[model samples]
Target: MRLSRSLAFAALFLLSLTTASVAGPGRITLPAEVTATGQVIRLGDIAVLEGPATAALGDLTLGPAPAAGESRTLEGARVLDALRRAGADLAAITYTIPPVIRVRRASQEVSEAAVRQILEGFLAEALGAGAADAELKSVELPGPIRIPAGPYTARVVPPADRPLLGRVRLGLEFTVEDRPVKSVWVTADIGVYGPVVVATRAVARGDTLAAADLTTERRDLSQTGRSVLTDTVDAAGRIARAPLVPYTPVRRDQLVLPADIHRGDVVLLVAERGRLRITAPGEAREDGTRGQQVHVLNRLSRKDLVGHVVDGSTVAVDF
Candidate 1:
């Protein structure tokens, strides 16, 4: 009986030992308080120092390598490895984390509109790692940061050995605003009767009259000669405007003529008055009032001249 019992116990112990050794290949053994020691992996003769991690991995281990023509997710593996390297304390690590992204196309202050990139990473937790370093950066959280709303930059550094290499973040920024110009108005004189002027050219709101504006006539001639009289019409567009300046000393830049006048610049004899005789005999076709002198043809002279016809046959000259 004693011999049989001894054999049974030995068998059970052997069975327990065997069971402890294996669990579908993955459960790696790591002492409860073991400092991470990095691994030097070999690819043929080349060796790469991988990581120093205290991983408490479960039922998952390296499987067979992919066949020569197989395609795989490089981004996925890269992200996984990055996370694995980040959290060296393994037993505590459970869920997978979002990838750390480096954004290059972003806009920031100082560097105005241009091709920019903002590096970013999604952390399962903020980890609150403040800023990133030159070679690496920390991904910033989503939401508005800084001016000119846009991509926030950051970098990711997988923890090597020393004190969990800190994370870093930066924001892209810029400035902009709307600007405008000024508009002006044209100066003009508007009234009920239209632009007002006199024999004295109307005073433009802010203007000084000079010598040319005055008119004076001396050595009056009874004989009529062709001459021009300019005048300005009203808003009615009628040319019936009367002469503003008579014979006088029309000064230079003075208020002598109408504000506007440039028309039938010819003289004609029409009528006469008292002892003072004007242009000679002429047909009183239009607006030929008595005192209005105009041009008339002298039958003897056969030429047009200014004269006042006292009656049907009698005529006088204002020469």
Candidate 2:
């Protein structure tokens, strides 16, 4: 009877040794709060590795990740219970537990208009003066995109040419309140209108401009330069500096006042003050346009005098 009892006791002791060896002797510390990647809790993810944590976690398992905003707790008793389940020895091991666990979710649902406003502001800044007459026409979206509910910033990557008039494709980027995060490609349409001078017909170089030769056309002036002529009267009676193509926008510098006086032409030079008038016969020394000062040789005195051109054959000098 004594021998049988000794053998049974020895067997029980061996079993306990085996259990302790499987659990090991490392200690684990849990964090107060952590972000959950999915619906399952990972012991390794939250475990604070202060000392021998790796070895103590042998075969330890925490089942099913937490859902978003979910909470859990790990007290001293709970830590011991988990370790015991994993076959870790209680006497040799130590562990720390968090008072409470809180879940942090990364995404939220936001409205479509909020995003649209951000894009609109960004596009306006990108267009500069081009947006003066321009307006946001439409935004082509591919169904609903993934934007969470929160304050975010946006910017645009315009095409090689800016002030994108009409339809254009651009790159848009979004950031979570000062932190850069996401990007998307979208198509947009812009409506733009401004006054511009258009050639009504083909005009040869040096041709004197008439009202019928040009007209004002409302067109997309986002990409147009400010120097483009916008009024027909501003260009009427001016000489074309270059050949103009029909239906093309005319530039302000492309035309000048037509010359009304030619070199060597006979002109009547007159000086008048309060109806006191003096007239002289003069020969034009240079081509002169209306409002231009030109030199002329007085026939009787045979002296050169400067006079303002009044018409094709007349000049006025203030004596």
Best candidate (score: TM-score): 2
Cα miss at 225, model 2 (Å)?
A: 3.0
Q: Which residue pairs show backbone clashes in model 2?
A: 23-88, 39-65, 40-64, 40-65, 41-64, 41-65
Per-candidate Cα RMSD to the true structure, in Å, reads 28.1, 12.2
Local error of candidate 2 at residue 36 (angstroms) = 12
Every candidate's lDDT: 0.30, 0.72
Tell me the TM-score of each prediction against the true structure.
0.14, 0.42
Model 2, stretches more than 4 Å misplaced?
1-119, 122-132, 135-150, 153-191, 265-283, 290-319
Query: Tens-digit lDDT track for model 2 on 1-319?
Result: 9999999999999999877755665556676676544334556656654335356563355655443234554454665577677776546655567656554433444335755676678767876776677777778765555443356666778889755776778777776656555577777777678888988899999998899888888887655566888888898888999999998889888898867999999999999999799999999999989889999999999988999999999999878
Candidate 1 residues lying further than 4 Å off, grouped into runs, are 1-76, 84-92, 97-259, 266-319
Give residue 42's error in model 2 in angstroms: 22
